[model samples]
Target chain A: MANTMLHINHIAKTFNPGTITEKKALLDVELTLNEGDFVTVIGGNGAGKSTMLNAVAGVFPVDSGKIEIGGVDVTHLPEYKRAKYLGRVFQDPMTGTAATMNIEENMALAMRRGQPRGLKWGIRPMEREMYREQLRTLGLGLEDRMQSKVGLLSGGQRQALTLLMATLKTPKLLLLDEHTAALDPKTAAKVLELTEKIVAEQKLTAMMVTHNMKDAIAIGNRLIMMNAGRIVVDVSGERKKNLTRAEVMGLFEKAAGEELDGDRLLLS
Target chain B: MEIIKLINALPGCVSQGVIWGIMAIGVYITYRILDVADLTVDGSIATGGAVATVLLMAGVNPWIALIVAFVVGMLTGLATGIFHTFMGIPAILAGILTQLSLYSVNLAILGKANLPLNATKLELLISQRNVRALSLDNPLIVLAIVTAGVIALLYLFFGTELGCSLRATGANNAMARAQGINTNTNKVLGLMLSNGLVALSGALLCQYQGFTDVGMGRGAIVIGLAAVIIGEVLFSKIFNNFALKLLAVSIGAVIYFVVIQVVLWLGLDTDFLKMLQALVVAVFLAIPYWKGKYFNKKTGKGA
Candidate 1:
């Protein structure tokens, strides 16, 4: 039995509808993922990749269509209401974790995501020990500095901590919106490696949006290409594993009937 | 002789400081923890004083009257919270709207400009008459206990799940929502808790002065901000603990009042007090911004 983990059906979203600045961000976008599937999404600027992720996250109500998570209809759910089933890491490290709070506190928050938060102690002694072990896995020496505020950390450290926070509760679907785009190349590679480790260990269903073409091909079991607010190409299984950067560009051009602009989809 | 006069005024300044210090703690919740400069306290404090005085005059228990005052104050916060969250108004404007409407509501509660809680007829929790008294009835002793109790309760509350959520909401709305925390409800809850303390402080202030005046809280927000800034400047390096931060706020209020006493004893005109207070707060508030813009710029990172 192949259970569907995420179902985004014929969804459409238009920003500032009926205005001068109107943008059809997503038009008839349909996507579905099975349990434990890791899909990589690649697109140009304004290609609607992030918008689709936001739609699934329920950042705003879609103009049309329905979405389901774990076979449960969530089209009308608000962002926070839908948060129980999803873990999200944003492109900007600042958007994923609370800076003023300490590392242990941030993890404690993620550990209880979707759970009823009440008058109980926010972090228990046992939970602290567990968090210490989890932080050690990052190999970033954060375990010893659990009490340090998240604001004091470098961008790479924050991104790693956010990745750990997102998967702490084992979300039904993990959305990574270019989670390492803001970091230096060295740090970016390190965080990417960590992301792979976490997803594999948890057997998590995931969607990763990236600008680097090599990353889209080299990682994830499936690859999706988007252009002009719709998916232009999708490949999975063994085909996705053997794909090269040049092949993806050729596929994009053939499917969209337009040259894949070098600036938008970098081969290198 | 002048030194003796200043020394004689010390006890009164300390007691009044403690009363306003509690109000400052309430301000600390919105200003420091929630990142909101809530002006609702100005009117809500008057509302608390009005409710307490009216109830005390009608033969209610002092403690019970204070509780009622606290509840009413929380209602004012709810109104502002709804305006800001549900109605999509800016936080500052929401607070201002509630503060404006509360003036009429408070007048209706009292039905006059002022109401007296005479010590001769009514048993008070704390009173100005006991400033020189050595008994437990001394306003200083009673207020200190209340301040300590309030700080302890707040410290515990902030360590709880719901409390951390509220803190997270203040720290970052986007992250809080991403974590499945409802930022709207948390903001409203924070507002309610803050105003409840503000009202409680107002109730104590009413009892201490033996009267509740509708205009008593006119500049209350300034006093609260003054206390918060003073506390931050004096104890930010030393008091990293939550409870100590609150205690710093209370002590800050005491220092504020003592300074005022010294200025008065030095023959400054009484009419210039409000302007003086506003000036002091403005300068202190600008210091951080100026430091970041001018002094810290050379450090090579803005963070």
Candidate 2:
């Protein structure tokens, strides 16, 4: 068996399809990730990078095609229903976690994601120790402040907490939609380091979308570049490790058959 | 002394307060927890009273009649929920639609504008006649126990997994859905729960007052909002626990009724009471908004 963890089959999506402002956001996109494969995605503005992530996350229905996670088809699943099989962290720090809830409570919710919630107490006494231990791994001294509301935390701390919540249950597929983009550079590096540690330790299959070319090149086992609703370039393993920004730009120009002039894709 | 007369009427005020307090708690669930200003209570309260009064007239047990009223109130919430979620109507408009439709429904249930439960013929749980009666028959004692029970049950329920998800849905729908909770379903469930409690309180009120009128619930949402706001303003600092917060709401309702009785005793025209209440609630509601806008200036100058 191929043991593919995520398979996006010829997916297509459009925004305001019948209007003058209609934009085809995704165009017959296909991708497959095997177990332990961490893929980084890069694209410029108006590209389909975030749309592809949204499509997989089921933020809205794709116009056509199917998606499968761990061999189970989820094309028709609503966002919440699909959440059972995937862990998603959004670009906005405020998007990923409930700010009004305490840290332990947020973790408890993630721990039971996809499980049928019943009348049982949301956070059992025994789960506290486990939550503390998990928070300790963040190295933010958050373990001691488990009862603090998440809203009191800084943007960086909230993003880190959101990352922990996403991975706490060991989801079959993890989707990162520029999860670190809202942080200071220092915090971004720290969050990315934590991301690497968790994914490596758990051997999680993940796809991360980023605007930073260097970060995209450096973070994952595989790299794919999207443009105008299609993946234009893909590289993996030894070839991906040695790739440089200039060469990647050259590859984009050659594949896209145009000068790489989008100001949104940060070469630095 | 005027104060002495107000003191003499305190027990009656407390009994009425106890009944309205339960209704206010129901409003709290939707207004505070579910974050929707559900107008269903205005109609559902009367629906509850109508059902209970009609059933009691038919010689049904008061306890069973209360449950039936609660179930009917839940149906009103269900209608509003379906209107909002399934039909894609805005939550406020959906509630208004339910409230409007429930006018005819309440009338149909009672077969008139009002129905009276004769205390001598009907077996009642609590009655205004016994409000001054210092015994187990007193409506105050029964209502107090019932309020305490409700507060205890609500405390336990909110601590549960399902309840937490419902709270999360109110707090943040985006996050709730991302965690695999169906926000629409939770919204509907919350409305149902809120309206159910409102109806139960209505049933109790009907029996206590010995009558159910179609117009009994007019301006009821304001009363519920007044109770909630007053409770938060006065007891929020002291009541940190969820259960204590609910208790504060009950206390708030008591204070509200006591204040009204004082106003009545003070010889203020009774016609102006509703306007006075509207102004009081409006001012209180404005305080937080004003604090955020003007008092908390970024320059840190004293207001």
Best by TM-score: 1
Most accurate candidate by DockQ: 1
lDDT string for model 2 (B1-303, tens) is 467888889999999988999999999999999999999899999999999999999999888998899899999999999999999999999999999999999999999998999998999999998877878999988798889988999999989999999988998888899899999999999999999989999999999999999889888888999999999999998888889888888888889999898888989899998898888889989999998887568557753
Model 1 ranges off by over 4 Å: B300-303
- For the candidates in turn, chain A alone yields TM-scores of 0.98, 0.98
Between which residue pairs do clashes occur in model 1? none
Cα RMSD of predicted structure 1: 1.6
| TM-score of model 1's chain A | 0.98
> What tens digits encode model 1's per-residue C-alpha lDDT throughout B67-102?
899899899999999999999999999999999999
For each candidate, the alpha-carbon lDDT, in order, equals 0.93, 0.91
lDDT score, candidate 1, position A41: 96
Per-model fnat list: 0.78, 0.77
lDDT score, residue B27, model 1?
98
Quantify how close model 2 is to the true structure by its C-alpha RMSD in Å. 1.9
